[model samples]
Target: MIELSTVYFGLLGIALITYATRLSGLIVMDFFPLTKRMERALDAMTGSVFVAFVVPAFYKGDIGVKLATAAALIVMFTTKKILLALTAGVLTAVIARAVLG
Candidate 1:
């Protein structure tokens, strides 16, 4: 029972809010100068996100997770390719869970 006008206005509101938020970030960054420490912190933030995701798995995950992590590390060290290693690790975990569980 939703009307077209309602959907249109809802989408327009979302677009306006998203654009304003992104534009505000650009405006603030333009006015500020990035220091060396700030640059390093920003760089580390990227890896911190991934580490945050994996750290929890190590703490509470089953044997499948451990094997997957070890496989991922081995592939990363051997091939030096992150995407391939991640895919392999995920596939390994899926297969391990299917077989073991």
Candidate 2:
């Protein structure tokens, strides 16, 4: 039988491993030289990761949440107002939740 303390330590170890894996690129990438192709690949990877993170949130989300977030993103892109965009997004989510529930 696993002790509770052992389970806690196991979970903590897994969390640490996950964090380290994510951070390893940032920590180690600078040590190596990036070729021109590598640079372009990195740039494309960055955009792909950004869209991958954001797109699902929009498509899989409720209509209100998607609309609110899309509006906030558009406002941010057009006006370059980070705070306002974030506020709008949060407010939209809250309002959507309230109304939908």
Candidate whose lDDT is highest: 1
Q: Write the per-residue lDDT of candidate 1 for residues 1-101, one digit (tens) a residue.
A: 79999999999999999899778757877789778898899789979989999899787999789878989999999999999999989998999999996
lDDT of 1: 0.90
Clashing pairs in 1: none
Model 2 clash pairs are: none
TM-score, predicted candidate 2 vs. hidden true structure: 0.65
Q: What overall lDDT goes with each candidate model?
A: 0.90, 0.86
Model 2's number of clashes is: 0
RMSD of each: 5.6, 4.5
Model 1, TM vs. native? 0.60
In model 1, which range of ten residues has the least summed lDDT? Answer: 21-30
Off by over 4 Å in 2: 1-32
